[model samples]
Target: MLWLDLEGAVNVRDVGGIPTDDGEKITRGRLLRSDNLQNLSPADVTYLVDHVRLSTVVDLRSPAEVAAEGPAPLTRLGHITHVNHSLLPEHGFDATAEALLVRRKREEERFPGDPSCAHYLGYVEERPDSIVAALRAVNRSPGAALVHCAAGKDRTGVVVAFALTVAGARREDVIRDYAATGERLHLILDRLRSSPTYASSVDSVPEDHHRPRAETMEAFLEQVDKRHGGVLGVLGSNGFTDDELDALRRRLRT
Candidate 1:
């Protein structure tokens, strides 16, 4: 969506620098999106941590995935503070059919506002506080922070979209960012499967469960637009202000 196709790594890059409908660029490095870092090679992690100055990590996977995958590696790093905003319930998305069967309209209702989107409405409603939480955490550290879900799509995408929208990225631009995950996901899925954590998972997430596919994002994209009239409506509905959002975008982008 936002990120043009780049090689070398998946789920890496700033959500800023991408131009919005209003013609402003989102800048770069303020918002890094990706699949879980649990599978990153030491070298990749080192590069991101050292160069990007990774300061905080947001894990958006379900609790079942976390217990199965274990804590993300970055959490244990020197001074990084790890936060989990588990979006899906224990056996959710992995079994989309069942999720839909049980929560059909639930998923539909959460967008544009919280306590609705079947999987993550609650978090969206409460995330301005999380944004402030991240700001406080970064205040205690030095560099960048990363936001992720199992496949770096969906839950993580919504949060990334939320942050960018608040930061002044246009609504369409935010949708583009959410769409970019599909391209990035291909690069990392195989490596993630090799991790010891997956082997021990009782609630083993299937291959399809990870990675943000274009179709899935599209579904939410349409929903968000229809439900909230794009970024302004949904976020405004959530209580983030124009001035406060600008402050966040400026600080993160620069």
Candidate 2:
């Protein structure tokens, strides 16, 4: 994965050129991942739409977040298809202190060893439909598909990991890509702290806690393998078809 510098977003990157197990590489301009695009400047939009040929946006934020933040700049573009597939549960919309506490408790219960890993696992266990649908949107995109959430670390990380795994990318590379976010955790948190929709959640946590660790993703993928067989196993059990999986591999790899 390679980072893309943009004026409006800090964590935007192209998930291309990743090597697969069979010595193939993921094609550039086919997939991207990013933080929220609410503040995207006109130039950033032009670069993504014209230069990157971005065609689809798989937003993994709750309905309340989308509504709270209002329409993103890309939504104004007539040609781009925007799909919202929130990985959070229905009650995730409530951003209250109590709600956040309860959510964290639930995450700990899912995997007491690592709540972060369990949170990642919850994307598949609790919201498999959204996970499968998001993958389908990526596969069906005519050009590039950009998947994103608020900080582009958890929800975006999980989805991008699944995409790369399904496309046969090496396991270490997947974890590396997820951990890459740690390099920009400061910038990501700054952006989140500036937005009302996310400030409370971000401000309440320590800076170190916001960092994405390699072990978190490593454990998440290990559990996916242990419980669901693998990334493909989770998708297959969630109604993703074999033909669709093949198409996804073809779409991302060269």
lDDT of 2 by residue, 1-254 (tens): 78999999999999898899999888899999999999999999999999999999999999999999999999998899999999998867676779878888888888898778988888888899999999999999999999999999999999999999999999999999999988889999999999999998797768898889999999999999999999989999889999999999999985
The candidate 1 region of ten consecutive residues with least summed lDDT is 1-10
**Relative to the true structure, how large is the alpha-carbon lDDT of every model?**
0.58, 0.92
Candidate 2 global CA lDDT score:
0.92
Query: TM-scores of all models?
Result: 0.68, 0.97
lDDT score, candidate 2, position 251: 92
Write the residue-wise lDDT of candidate 1 on 48-120 in tens digits. 7677677777776667678777755566686876776555554653556756565646545554332223344
| Predicted model with the maximum lDDT | 2
